[model samples]
Target: MSQNDNNTDQKKSESHALVKSDENGHALTVKGKGRLLALTDSILKSAIASRKANQLAVDDSWMQEIWNWADSFTISEKKIPRNRQMLLGLTELDISGNLLEILPESIGNLTNLTELNLQQNMLSELPESIGNLTNLTKLNLQNNRLSELPESIGNLTNLTELSLRDNRLSELPESIGNLTNLTELSLRDNRLSELPESIGNLTNLTSLDIFGVRLSELPESIGNLTNLTELNLDYNNLSELPESIGQLNNLTRLDLSRNELSKLPESIGNLTNLIELDLSSNNNLSELPESIGNLTNLIVLDLSSNNKLSELPESIGNLTNLTELNLYNNRLNELPESISNLTNLIKLSLHGNKLSKLPENIGHLTNLTELDLWSHNLSELPESIGSLTNLTELNLGYNGLSELPESIGNLTNLTVLDLSNNELSKLPESIGNLTNLDSLSLHGNNLSELPESIGNLTNLIELFLSRNELSKLPESIGNLTNLIELFLSSNKLSELPESIGQLKNLTRLDLRNTMVRELPTSINQNRVKVIL
Candidate 1:
């Protein structure tokens, strides 16, 4: 009886296993059992396939040859693939703006890399292995905290362009001269106090920027780069240039501004091909070499802010091709008549000088577009000034100008005219002929009234008449419909002309300390800010 009961129970258990129940405890049919078995097999196959695909991806990731981790990539050695073939095939790697504080030494394994950009990072030092990138033609390490470079950096002989700007580097490795193929090198805004004499070995260099360095002198070997066309040595402490600099006959532009240079080497005149030269802000520069006249090709020359520069070489006239000449803030009392020979001059600035008069032939520069003679002792301008019909901007403020030449009316193209802080008791009626003037400054003057013809300046957007003796404004003042700013502060104006209300575009009306006690009802107080 026990054997029979055991066999029956085993059979019942098998049957129950083949059936399934719904939430309500239901039994399954044969077809349903078959369907369930097929579904389970399909799920197992998908799981196995997905696992294989994931494994394949992991295996192939190491074959990637290009890596661009700009900004979004996190620095982690474990995340980089370690395959040798992948490293050898990688030709470009950019990790700019990644805030990377440290680069892995293993990066040198990418021996085939031609371009590497690590700009805008926090890196203070580079691995010595960096020199191993002999195939690299371009490398940018700008805006980093590096104070020095590995001497092995000179090993990158193939480098043509390298930027180390905005770093703390105080000196460069002499081995850097090994990059004979370098055409462009930038070391701007670094702490470098001197350049290695070996730098002259880079004869192929055409552009070299060493701006904002502390260099007091350049090596004579620099002249060996006869192929150089541009050299920027601005904001340095250089007091003099090596005479050998004249050997760079190919130079088209040279900047020695903001230095302590007291004089220039006569050999500098040998650079006959120079097109632009800047020597501004050199407080100790007292004179220029007479040989400077040899630069017949010079088009732009800036000698501004050199307080000790009392005179210019007479040979300056040889630069007939000069288009711009800036001599602002010097001690020159007069200009050489030869200056008038520069018919190509487009801009001439002589402001903040002791010049009592300009060359009588200054008017010959008909091509002049801008002339700044402000802050000078000039009491009168040559009538020839009016001959500069092409002039659009003229500054004569902070001067002893008691009168203007009648010929000034001929400058029909003038858009800006500044005559403030002068002894002008009256303005010539011809001043009204400057119909294109957009700004007219007459503040700090003795004008008690404006000429009625002033209304002819319909394009006037700004009119400065503060600190003047203007007791009344002409009715024509309202004719300046485009005027947005009217300065009448510290004036003797006791009342406003009803025509003043015609200035529909006026937004600012300065009347502080004026005699006026109230505004005219015609004025739109809501739109105009009246300063009392």
Candidate 2:
């Protein structure tokens, strides 16, 4: 049987044997035997009914033990009534994962209770008496049917954390502001359309999560939470924020993605302590306030999928501490030369933009580790690009490039280089200098021949040169002993160098649509899978 079933059966056996019919009659045995009272009012009421039926007789001593055991209680998976007497000194109560529909007003009588978990229950409302537990520090009512909290909840002055997530709560009582000591509050996945201005009274709050809701606007008073360090309000319908948000000078992380924000207040720059900001997927936002540059401490910033953003403020370069910046899927036509000021940038994405060219000083970003400029109208890369020696991945595919700078070979750190679907007729012999290259793609080009120097990329694992006018591959191709997949289909080649057979590590080679009539005898002798 399942462990849960065994425990349930054992609990039933223990409850039935609590009062033996022997001469002992309702004996309260606290010996090596099972528990004499293992449940709360749910089972205790059944015990009482049994006693009244003359099946078992309980004395005052037995009743005392029942009351004490109720201090730490549970009514889980049982049908119980709200009128059950409250255990006055109860310190902990767990009625979670139950069918409870209501909490009795007598719960307040348990003034000593410090923690209460009522998650995963059918509770639609809580008794106002709950506020009487002034000593309570933690309360979890998540995954319930509660549409509102009792106004008296503010009376639990000592509460540190309150979670009402995944509930039907539409609004919070103004008295909730009385929770002066609360530090964490989560109301995510609710239909809360607005917050009470009194929410600002929570001066001690450090973390607040109201995401997955349709809150169109936050109360201006929310800025009063000076102690807040993290605020997540994503996936909401918020179109604008109050200027008072700048008051959160202590905030370090802010997420406002997936919102309907069309603009931001200049006060946004006031978050000087902010380290990470996400404004992605907010298609309605066309531009960011210049004040954004004020987040000098920011390390990561995402502004992708803002189609109307035609340009970025030059002040963005002021974020010298930025390590990752994403501006993909926008209508940007040009990047400010100031972008070179982000010397600490490790990754930058400018894909799917309307840019015809990049800033001449683009090469000034020496710390870039990954640069993606796919699907642009660029004609050529600046010679300065060779200065990005730290670049490990570079994507310049689907562009109008016809030639590359010889300096490109200076990026010896490149592991994956994509130059497909371009107008290039030939590559600079300097391409052979990328000894550390792992994947090289030069497909869909006008190339008529590859420089013999191409063979210098001995570390290449994947080489795609399909749809080219090449008549023959440089014999040096055989030098890539580590090559695994090679695509040379749709070429004019009639023969391959005998050295091709030396690539023992090659598993797949494609030569379809080519003029090749026969494979090298050596290739036919190896385990390589040739595809024609």
Candidate 3:
């Protein structure tokens, strides 16, 4: 028609115009035809109306939250909860995989809920509409079946993180001082008894685990939390403590081990940033608070099974950066040479004490590496304990020592040397110069013999000279060869030194009440087990 109808309408407007190809670039993955299929059908109808407006704003923020016990089989029902008032656009709710046992009353219409996760539920009681959430701030009722907990939960008042771990709560709601913006409060394995003075008003708690609760007392307003830093009342039933717990003062790890505490308040040395202090199995403690040497930033101090301690306060050598000092089953007979001022002690446990002697400044600690004076009542030892030399574990078992101080061959970094039930007849041939001895206990000793320099220990492995009074032994104790448990029981040793069949890692060879009636046919006798 006029230029062939405008050249066919300019080739149908260049086939719908949105073209590509400016060089070798070919991503015009031409799907439909020209004009880019009407601009890809108007951009797929505006991306389906922007994905239905983001799923209608996530279903209107989960239908204004609040009590949404979205079920999954948490134990069936107990009903009652329903969305009350416009639930203040409830904050977060999931009533956790439920089986509800109670806790409904429409949680007082979510007073602007903050965060409430009812973990694995089957709740046993709680809803006083949880005192209207009051803007809760993280409250997870972990593994529930709660055995009670609602003094209207002290009206939430902006909680800061409270998890009632594994519940069966025995009692708590002293209006938990109304949450007071808590900060990590877990009642581990609950059965809690007493703890209400409004939980000392939280005072901005900082980690407080009530492990295995049965708590006997603590409400001296727990010194108002004072910003705690790790406080676990382990195995509770506390016998005493309210010295306003030295007002917390930013404590750092305090586990009152198996409680029934026998005493401790010298204002507990005012915490002084304590670092791990566990009063192990309190056994009616016999005493211990010379202001705990003011905690000198303690580092692991566990007074093990307090067996009526008999001594230890020279301000316990002022701790001096103590590193693991557990006084096991005590009744101490001696030790405080101010423990030679600890000298950066490294694991020193005086097991079952009744000590006979030790303070020759016990070789000034020398950065000791595990030294347990087992059973104690020692008969001798202080040759300045052979200058520790970073000893690697040395337990002087059930003492009454017969002899040893040849400056124990300067401990050549001993590797476990437990001189079992002592009365040792003799040993210091410079203890075969240790050579990293690997476990050597002269069990119930009185050794009749054993020194060809014990064939230089050769990294001996578990060689306990059973109930000894040995009649004879040195063939260099058969060159150890990494022996494993070679106890010569009640020895009177009748015979058997064919180099004790050159032990090939003998696994237990106790010549019971020995007069060794036999054994030595190249002693493997089926991987040895000779208990007689």
Candidate 4:
């Protein structure tokens, strides 16, 4: 018999196959059908059609509107033949959110398709035929079970955006290099361990998000993607990067936080366009590359939470444009004098460090607004600190400071001041000059009493004088009408000041551990809420 006759005979045989289950009972069996079993084919297509229609019916009007916009559709159970190219060519196809375990070989026919979103599906693999959709620009396969891609995928030369986030992909095919037109790619929250070496072919890519991946290193070819503007590798296991990364000259934002990186390549200085670089919470980092000084355009740099870092390079002074610099939670004992060169710095956080003293030239940072030196071993501030007239928030809490310079009064713009947990016995009477101050904390100190000038800070809002040896508050305390939260716990005070009742904005008062045995009549009437 001829080939045509043989195919016809086979189709006839499959049409007569015995029924297995008719859960929905919408299909009928035809006699003499072969491999292209008529009953099986119709049953599968109707099942997929029913599923789509059901989903669309239950969806809100917005989704129904989208369904209407999708010009193409799919029906389950039908084997899309490899040669049936004309059967495709639909603009949008929704074969996603289904129980599909395999892709059909006939999907290559959809050359005009613009979007293919198959999210929340059980698809484990894609057919090489999909490469035929050269006109496809957006492909979203998030929340899928796919572990690999076909080499033919590279043929989708027109694809601009691809999202495979939250998938089980372990690796990518070299054929991926063919997607040179791609601009954005997301592999976030996936199990990917490494990226394909051919990924460098995507030179036009602008954004790449691979957060929470298991990537340990990137291929040197990645540096070829100089057009990338944003690169996110947060929460990864990367230990180092290729020196070629410095070639990403156009990159503006780079996030390498929460990684295991111990060092950065000196080549990183080549990224002159970098505006923000986050290397926070990398506990193993011991030092920064001196080449970092080359990033003169950097606006923000975070090296916080690297407890093993011992020092910063003097080259840091080269970041003259730096606005925010964080070195918190480190073991740094001293800063280089070159640090005084960051004259434009606004917020400098060196909190929870082991610093003994600051550079004498620190006063050069006249533009600083917040200076956090909390938990350091600092015993004194340079008299030059009086030059930081722009400073508003100053944190010297948890330090070994025994005395403050009278020059502290020079900070006329000061608002929040934290001197808690220190060995201070007296504050300079000149402290009263900080009239703009709103928050003042002197808790856990050796103070016996506040200077009467404390009453001069009429704008004070939160006052924490707890855990001290104070015997009494001045009658002038009532002048602070803006006082809100007052903590007087763990003190030696014996009586409440009648003036305390004048703080109408007060919200909470703590008298715990104090010698006060009786409350004022007004306080006893629940007029002022106090914790004793």
Best-fitting candidate, scored by TM-score: 1
Model 4 TM-score relative to the real fold: 0.80
RMSD after CA superposition, every candidate: 14.4, 15.5, 22.3, 12.6
For model 3, the local distance difference test gives: 0.80
Q: Against the true structure, whose lDDT is highest?
A: 1
- Across 1-532, the per-residue lDDT of candidate 2 in tens digits comes to 8999999987776555443343346554342242433433436687678777663233333334434433325542222223224444467777678666776665566677899888998888988888899999999999988898888998988999999999998999999999999999999999899999999999999999998879999998999999999999989999999999999999999999999999999999999999999898888899989999999999999999888889899999999999999999999999998999999999999988988987878999999999999989998889999999999999999999999999999999999999999899999989998889999999999999999999999999999999999999888889999999999999999999999998989999999999898998889545778878
Candidate 3 accuracy as TM-score: 0.34
Question: Can you write out model 1's per-residue Cα lDDT over 1-532, one digit (the tens) per residue?
Answer: 6999999987775565445454357764434456778856875897799899997665344333223331235534333434445555778877788788876565665788899999999999998989989999999999999999998899999999999999999999999999999999999999998999999999999999999979988999999999999999999999999999999999999999999999999999999999999999999999999999999999999999999999988999999999999999999988988898999999999999998887779999999999999999889889999999999999999998888888989999999999999999988889899999999999999999888999999999999999989899999999999999999999999999999999999999999999899888989999999999
Q: TM-score for every candidate vs. truth?
A: 0.84, 0.80, 0.34, 0.80
Cα displacement (angstroms), candidate 1, residue 526, comes to: 2.6
Q: Can you tell me which runs of candidate 2 are displaced by over 4 Å?
A: 1-111, 117-129, 143-145, 524-526
Quantify all predictions' global Cα lDDT against the true fold.
Answer: 0.90, 0.87, 0.80, 0.86
Clashes of each: 0, 0, 6, 12
Per-residue lDDT tens digits for candidate 4, residues 1-532, read 9999999988776656554556856553434535337667877899999998886555434333333323223443232212223234357665667655665554554567888878887778888888888889999988888888888888889999999888888888888888999999998988888898899999999998989989988899989998999999999999999999999999999999999999999999999999999999898999988999999999999999987899989899999999999999988999989989899999999999899998889999999999999999999999999899999999999998889999999999999999999999999998999999999999999999888899999999999999989999988888888988889999999998877888878878899988888866544335557888
Candidate 4 Cα misplacement greater than 4 A, ranges = 1-110, 119-129, 522-524
